[model samples]
Every structure is written in structure tokens, then in C-alpha cells.
Target: MKPTETDSTAVDWRGDSASSPDVTRRERLKETYEARVRTPALVAWADWRTRFGLLIIGGYVLMALVAVLGLWREPSTSQAPRLLGPFTDMSYPLGTTQSGVDLMALVIHSTPTILILITAGAVWATLIAVIIGTVAGYKGGSVDRGLMSFSDLVMAIPGLPLVIILAVTLNPENPVVLGVIINISYWAGLGRSLRSQVLTIRENNYVEASRTMGISTPRIILKDIIPNLMPYITVNFVFAARYVMFASVGLYFLGVLPYSTQNWGVTLNFAYSNGALFSWQAAHWLLAPMIAIMGLSLGLILLGQGLDRVFNPRVRTRMAGESKSTVADDDDDTVTEVF
Candidate 1:
């Protein structure tokens, strides 16, 4: 049937109506952003592995916060259960160190400091990687050669030996210094990887279009390239945090760094040096810190692998069949109520 002039004149512009309106540029951009940015996070959260990994990570964070705030019982309370074995008493859970330090309290309290160190180191390293990789990859030529030469020089040197020397010579009390040294030690490899990623991003249609439209290199890289590489960045950042953690803990455990602080690594060092392993009864002291370190490392690795789905398009595509939207339909079901 032919519509009346009044009905035809009053166009229903709203998108959700029976006569669906044409999609606007703004709507397209919004959908694109959601698909590229928000959907992956939703997808990752929906995955069991990702959810479990996040739970582990969140547990540590909560424990660390409690410890740092001194709300995890009293520091003096840790001394009361001194020399007692695990499950010996409800008050003295997890036993105590020879120095009368409460085992659980010590481990919990030390968690925050180590987390801060590794997180800081990872951020520093990621920043270096992005800057160097983007510039080298995008600019290409003498800049690439010079930057690659610098990285090569550092990479050629024995990493462990260099880290040990630096740690021993520097102030061990300052976590910032330790974090910086870790960044210096590991940024080269990630920088190279970032450069390779940028090289690929350079050929992307949006990037080329921006270039053709007279956009500056730096702006284009920042606005377009970096956003695309978020998944790679997130994955690498997780790995880098885990790497520095292991390195720092190993250094502390080996007695290469000062043992004045109450840290898991320091506790392990003292436990080993003081013969905590001589008797089967004294196992909890060493085992406690060891377990914490292993848990942290495993959690980070799992988180990284899970995060791969959010950033890597290939992985996302492969998992597409399995991942369903978390959002519920507006009119999908009925609710039951009784008076």
C-alpha cells in the first residue's frame, strides 16, 4: 500500500525501529571500537582459563594489600608462633622462622614489595620497547641500525652475569634501582619484537591511509599502530614482569643482594643458609616462600596466554566458535515472582 504524505514526510530516523535506519559513520566507528577494543576483554573474561588466572592474580593482589596495610594480624603476632610447625596450633599457622617470625605473615607481607618491583620493571621495559620499536620500525634506516646496534651490544653481553654485577654494586635497598636494572637487562629482546610488529602494522590499510592523508609519523603510530599492538604489549608485559620477578628473586636467594629486608627471596636465602632443610620438620619455612614464587610465576604465564585471545586476531578467530557474548538479550526471558 502507498504511504500517506504525512507518514512519508515524518521519517523514523531511530535505528532500532521496524524501518531500520541507515547506519551512520559514528555508529560504525563505535561498533568498530567495541569489536576491536571491548569485545576481546569480554571474550577473555568469559574464558575459564582467563577467569582462573585472574582469580589467582586477584588473590595475590588482595593479600598483598592486606599485608602492606598491616591488617594481616600484627607484626608482633608473627613472633609468637616462632619455631612451631604448621598445624601445630590455630594461632600459629604455617610455623615460624628461627628468628620467631610468623611464616604466613612474612610471606604475605613480603608479597606487595615484590609485586611492586616486578610491575614497575615491566612498565619501564614496555615503554622502552614501544618507543624504540615504533621509531625504528616506522622510520627505518640509520635510526634502525643505530638502535639495533645498541641492543645488540647489550644483548651480546652475558645477561645474568651483568645483572648480578649491577645488583651487587648498586644499592639493594632501592627497589627502583633494581627495577631499572631489570628493564635494562630485558628491554632489548622485546624492543626487537615490537619493531617487527610495527613493521607489519606499517602496511595496514588504515596506517597507509593516514600516511596518504598527510598525518605525521608520530601521531599515526600513536593513534593507530599502538592501539593495534595492545594485545602483544599486554602479553609481553606479563612475561616481562614474571621474568624480572624470577631474576630478582634468584639474585636475592643467592645472597647476591643484601638481606636486610623481609622478602620471600631473602627468607629463602636465610632458610637455606640456616639449615632449614636439615630436619624434615623445618620444611615449611623454605616451602612457604618457594610456593609463593611458583604461584606468582604460574599465574602470570597463564594470564599472558589467556590475554592472547583478546589481542591476537588469529587466536580470536580460532576461538570464535567457543566465545559467546556476555551481554544478555533485552527480551530473552521471563522472571518469576510470588506474592
Candidate 2:
């Protein structure tokens, strides 16, 4: 026992104490506690800066539902304009056109058409961007030069004047047909921007590894490049929708589109023709369409903002933290030290 005690003292003197094992383990446990438990819990409960996304998505959903409902109903004649509900007078609930068409019915009926135009244009434009961007960026040389030059040529043509010229020349009566034409003017710039991004992403080591592993060019583009480009594409879709809507309205306002259609722009034109803006009693007619446009635009803007917060990891981290100290704590503890 005396020898054993002397050996233990020697070990301790050499700074190899065993009595501190429990303390070291406890320290390890504390570190584990902070890493595995506290950090995640704090992040889970923290405030999200992109809370507005839900609201934006909700608004779009509501508009879609309303449009769907309107699809089933027959167009109502406004011989005697009834206010919005069952009891109101000849004045429409929303108001009436000079021809006595109910504004509410017009708005409801036209919603789907507008949604179709917006959705189709957005999707088509985004597709053009992704395809052209990937091809031009991944394969430089003659291909890049030819595609980019073509893109620049398309961009140089002014959208409004060109759209007006096309509309006047084609005289398209169908909304869907006209919408397709509008998409042609939008994809060039979007394609160029996307191509620039693809050029940057393609040079990364991961893409190089995929190439070294002999991944097919199609596989690399579709499986690898496209997925990573989703956030940008999603945002671009929303912006494109807004742009298409504005273009559609502008064309309609200028009488370049079919005048008989119950589009929002047509309604605005009719309201102006009927002096709705100048007449105090008819001001609501002009105001309602303006409000609807603003609401839709705002909802899209908010949704895009929410998506930005979600897709950007840095923004996501910031969104995940409620307070400054909690954020700092997270940043400080992000790296694990192995011993």
C-alpha cells in the first residue's frame, strides 16, 4: 500500500492525475450539452424574418380559388346592375360598366385568365433561362458566343413597342396565344443572368469531381446544376409573373389587346371612358381594380422575400435567431474542437 501510494503521488507530480477524470468527463458532457441540445433548441424557437411568405402564399391561393369558382358560373348580364349581394340596387357590388356588366363578376371571371398568363409566362421564361444558361456557361467557345450573341440581339428590341407592333400585326383575339408572344420578349436577359451564375457554379470543386467521375453532360446539368439554381429560378418566376401582368395590362390599356375581354386593364379603360375617375359616386369603380393589382403585386414581393430568407443559408441562420446574443452564441459554437 505504501508503494502504491508513492506511485500514485509520482503520477500526480508528473501532471497525469486520474482524480480529475470525473471533472474532464463533466466538462465533456457540458460541451456535448451545449452542442447537441442548447443550440438547436434556441434556433428552433427563434424568430423567422421570412414570416411574410405564409401570408403571400395564402393570398395567391385565395385568388386561385376564387378564380376557379368563377370558372363554373355563366357570365352574368348587367342589364340592371345589382350591388354585390342579393339586395343591392342596379349599381354593382363592385360597381357597373357603362354597358351594365357587373364589375365583381368581371373581376372574378378575369382572374383565371390573368393567372394563366402570369403562370405560363413565368414558367416558360424560367425554362428558357435555365436551359440557355446551362448550355452557354458549361460549354464555352463557339456555342457560348453564338447563344450570347443571339440573346443580345433579342434584348436590343424594345419590349413595349415590339409587343404593340406584334399585337397590331397579328391581331390575336385569344388570350393564351397573346400570352405566348409576350414571353418571347422576356427570356433573353433572364437567360444571360442565369448563364453568368452557371459559369460561376460550374468552376467549383464539386462540379469538377463530378466531371472527373465521368458524369454525363446532361446528368451534370439536370441533376447537379439545375437543383442548385432553384432559389434564383423561383425568385425570377415571381418577378416574371409581375412583369407579364404589367405588360398585359399596358397592352390592354393601349387597345392593342382584344377590347371585348373582361380583363382588369379593359375594365380600367372602360372606367376611364365612363368618367368613373371624375365622378365621385363612381370612384369605387376605378379604385377597386387598382387595389387588386397592388395587392397581388405586394403578395408576390413578400413571397419572394420569404423564399430569399429560406434559400440563403446565411439568411436562414439570421432568421433562426431571435436575439443578438443567441445568434452570437450559435456562431461561436458552430465549430467542434476534437481532442
Candidate 3:
């Protein structure tokens, strides 16, 4: 049927009206998404706990750097001045041990030992955990049962007593060997947790979709699954570091690894053996190593907590409540809720 010009014009205007609403809706959605992303990164960084946690970590790094520089500088005959009272001589800042070696210098030298132990233990534990977990989780049934049994076996043994026996058997004079022994004590529980997480992640729709696309199992696990589990791995690593240090210190304290290779535990061992524990004058000697251990552990704990807030929705909400954002959606039911 032939139409009048007015009718044709009216049909064209109706077509435009139908399309306008959708385009406007899409634009609105795009703007909202952009705002959501940019706004949260800024707010998350500005949160007081995040700042406080970062500050704690930053202080530890600074102390580590100072210790490194102190080690790097040519050996000085003139020792640092003791400031912490009778526990140390006037020449030494923290004081000297019964051997008359500067506690400050020993502490500075020991930073490398602590760093090496933590790094070595974390690497081995993380590697073993990720491999065992991903493999067992992705291949269930018999494989899962076997791995779970193995994890249980490892967990059943008391850790410190075993570490002491092994450290004494190895009779480690080197920090690296000590670290490896310590790592042996750390990976099992982490592996079990990681396996559980991977089991759940493998069932995710995106993972199934990838599998349907003919992606190989290993590739899918590496690309699709492992990345999502990284936050959990990081949290475990922080705890692993503390655990390794605790084990190392336990060994040294128990007289299992007694040689002083500038290790803090060795320093504490020497201090305790020399009547520093009983004498009020030698308290700084006891205090120095204890403080370093405490500070390092506290920093890692707080950093782990901050990372939890960054990763876990539950912790994020608590942190956000403390920060108090008025416009931010606090509803738990919405998928779009950030924390």
C-alpha cells in the first residue's frame, strides 16, 4: 500500500523512539560500571587500616634496608653507642653479648638469615601446596583420597619435636639448610586448604565453559583456576613465614642448631646461656631479639589482615564499616556489593 509522506515520516519517528531508550540505558550502565571501579580503588587505598597496615610493613622494610646497609659498610672498629641502659656496654647501642660482640651488629647481620629462611620456606611450601592441591582437586576420587590421607599423615605428627630431631640430625651450620628443614614442616595443611578451594573453583561455570571449549585440563587449571586462588595463597604464605621462624627459633632455643652464624635465635641462645636472662643489666640483650621477632610477626599479621580485607568480602565489610562510606551499597544480597 502506498503511504502518504506524513505516514512515512511518522513510521520513521516511531523507529527512533524505540531505539533511544535502549541506547540511554546502555550509556547509563557503562557510566555506573566505570564509577564503581575507579571509586573503590581510591577508597580502598585511602582506608585507615589499609594505611596503618602499609605503614607497619613499610617500617619493617626500612629496618631491613638499614640492616643491609649496616652490613654493607666496611667493618667499623668503633661500635655503635649503647642507649638501652646496663644490659649493654656504652660502646654498643643494644649492648654486647658475653662474647663482647655488639648485639646491634649481630642483629643487623641476622636480618639476612631471617629473610632467607622466610623466602625459602615460603617458596617450597607454596610450590608444593599449589601442585598437590591443583592436581588432587582437579582429579578427584582415588587421587583426592590419597592426597588427603598424606596430608593427614603430615598433620598428625607434632611439628616442633620433629623439627628439633631433624635439625639436630642434620646439624645445620648454614641458614639455607635450616630453611629447607623448616619448610618441610609447613606445607601439608596449606595443601589441604588449597585443594579444597580448587575443588570448588573447578566447578565454577567459567571453568566448565572453558573445558567445553576443548581447553586442556592443565591449561585451564593454570589460566582459569589458579589466579583466582592467589589471594588465599598469599595469606597462607604470611602465616607460613611466621611458622618457619617459630620453628627455627624453637630449634635454636632447644640447643638443636647452636652455632651462631649471625642468626637471631642463635643470639638469643647465647644471651640465655650467659646469664642475660637473670641479670637485669643484660635485659636489653634479651629484649633486642624478642623485639625484632615481635615486630616482624606483627607486621606480617597486619599485612595479612589488610590483604584479607582486599580479598575476602566478609573482612572487607568490617573494614569498610570502620571507614564509613555513606553512598556505598552495604546490602549483602546484591552481587554488585564490593565488600
lDDT of 2: 0.72
Best by TM-score: 1
Could you give candidate 3's per-residue lDDT for residues 1-339 as a string of tens digits? 899999999999999999999999999997676445544444446556666767866776665687777643311343444324543354566666555567766666677678777778877888888888888898899999998899889889887778777877877766667777777847888888889998899999999999899999889989888878877987898888888887777677766774655567877876788888898877778888888888778877776655655555554455456544533445433546544
> TM-score: which is higher, 1 or 2?
1
TM-score: model 3 vs. ground truth: 0.70
lDDT (0-100) at residue 320 of candidate 1?
Answer: 53
Where's the lowest-lDDT run of ten residues in candidate 2? 82-91
Each candidate: what lDDT? 0.80, 0.72, 0.73
Candidate 1 lDDT trough over 10 residues, lowest sum: 330-339
Clash totals for all candidate models? 1, 3, 4
Q: Residues 1-339, candidate 1, lDDT per residue (tens digit)?
A: 897877665554332553343456668887787677666776687677788888889989998899878787754465474578887876767788887878888888888878888988998999998898888988889999899888778778888888778777875667766877866758888888889888898998998999999999889989989978888898889988988898888888887866555788888887888888886767888998999999988888878878877777766665553433323332233222221
Considering TM-score, where higher is better, how would the candidates rank from best to worst? 1, 2, 3
Runs in model 2 lying further than 4 Å from the true structure: 1-76, 79-92, 314-339
Model 1 alpha-carbon miss at residue 138, Å: 1.3
Better of 1 and 3 by TM-score: 1
The whole-model C-alpha lDDT of candidate 3 against the native structure comes to 0.73
- Model 1 segments beyond 4 Å from truth? 1-38, 74-77, 314-339
Off by over 4 Å in 3: 1-44, 47-91, 258-260, 312-339
TM-score of each: 0.80, 0.71, 0.70
Cα lDDT of candidate 1 equals 0.80
